[model samples]
Target: MNEFRIIEDLHRLQNQFASLWDPFVAAGGSVYPALNIHKGSDQVTITALVSGIDPDSLDITVSGNQLRLSGEVISGAPKSDLGANRVERFHGKFQRSLELPAEVDPEKTTAEFKNGILHLTLPIRESVKPRKIQVQSK
Candidate 1:
């Protein structure tokens, strides 16, 4: 193959690999802790799995329709007498941000940490919530 043809073929292979990996990252594979978002009539609930992390180390914030979650997982140093054969769990700082589907009231938002799960409840704006309309005879 000509020099230009070789480069073009390499670029095409790179594109194919990127396309295969993009879907996994887009589906929340990159985030440290997986998240589940539930949209209700009046509120939105976000749940994250943060097992083995200290509650005090977690930080949750909401800006407009975006929610940011950040925290650090500190692993204690192994004892001098013992040596670790294998390590699998992740340790260190991680942050994940998600854009909500609708506008929410940041002031009314509430969070709870229990059983290694962080749950955030964001109340939807009253103006954007579904409402019933009445019809009148002309």
Candidate 2:
């Protein structure tokens, strides 16, 4: 009856809706994920939420202005002797890409994955950075 419960219920409903549509996706086995991108003073950081995906299966590539994330996700079999009738996790091969707002040094990009999240840091090109200008009196 509370607001939190209502939110939780809505999330569950969304999950259910996703679950229903996922079978079709599974058959095709291709996905494009929406990623969250952030920028700092000298670096651009991207965090992608990719649960149930194997770290070894992921491939990342950065081109002139684009960053790509591609991977295959396989579902784990149930461990118990009792059969599981429901599966809610999303599975399949996914390839997601994001175009950087500004040019980044592709060679300096670093990637790390932990706790089902993929983190990427791309450093900005020094040439594009701002330098403090000094005013001279005439």
Candidate 3:
């Protein structure tokens, strides 16, 4: 029905307005791209929330025990909004490096960026993995 379509359109517009009003700083607006580093028995997994970034612009690298990620948010506006008065998406180069919690096998490190998210995996150095020790019940 026309009434139903009108309601749906209004809802969509309302959602867009809400997103526009929200402060970018309230979001992860940091140059670091906000990451979660997790350490496992054999690997370290790092996830970076790099939304609104161009996949082609991102660079992920691991050297020694350090992980470096850098990228830029290219200036882009919604097609329909090309004539609109204002825009909020960020633009510019951002860089951040993290000192890995422990030594990692640099050769085994790999990373992928999909839908504005970056996933990095680094294998733990063989010498750093915890070793099980036999204990005599004394």
Candidate 4:
């Protein structure tokens, strides 16, 4: 009935379409990295599994409520190595973008890479945080 509801419906339809095609396309490899996102009262945390990728190769950007992550993975196999029969590792460029449910403070965001995992902490905007207001009794 409203513009926001219409837009939300369209987004839901888009996700459903993507889900239907995911099984077919995922066999080749995922376009985006595996991710875990958690929202708390004061912050949002995102963790991505990116094994075998150098931290320096990653590019992270946050614009408003959107967060974008991109990077490349390079194989370390020797040039003179014998031919391999099976290869399941992922290489080359990959990127993923996500929209947050709440606004975040980009200036306070922090990222850390350790043990092949990228961890990001985004602080929620002060204006959007919930506050309890006391009612006055006359």
Per-residue lDDT of candidate 1, residues 1-138 (tens digit): 245445545554543354345443565453456678899988999889998899999988897788888898776546565555444455567766667888899999999999989999999988788888999999
Q: Between the candidate structures 1 and 2, which one is better when assessed by TM-score?
A: 1
Top TM-score hit: 4
Q: Which regions of candidate 2 are displaced past 4 Å? A: 1-34, 77-87
For model 3 the local lDDT of residue 59 reads 81
RMSD of 2: 9.8
Provide the overall lDDT of each model, using Cα atoms, as 2-decimal numbers: 0.75, 0.69, 0.70, 0.76
| Count of clashes, each model | 0, 0, 0, 0
lDDT of 3 by residue, 50-72 (tens): 88887878887787788777778
lDDT of 2 by residue, 59-133 (tens): 999876677788877867556756545544555565555568667898999988899888889997787767899
Clashes by residue pair, model 4? none
Q: When superposed on Cα atoms, how far off is each prediction in RMSD?
A: 9.9, 9.8, 10.4, 11.8
Query: Against the hidden true structure, what lDDT does model 3 obtain?
Result: 0.70
Ranking by lDDT: 4, 1, 3, 2
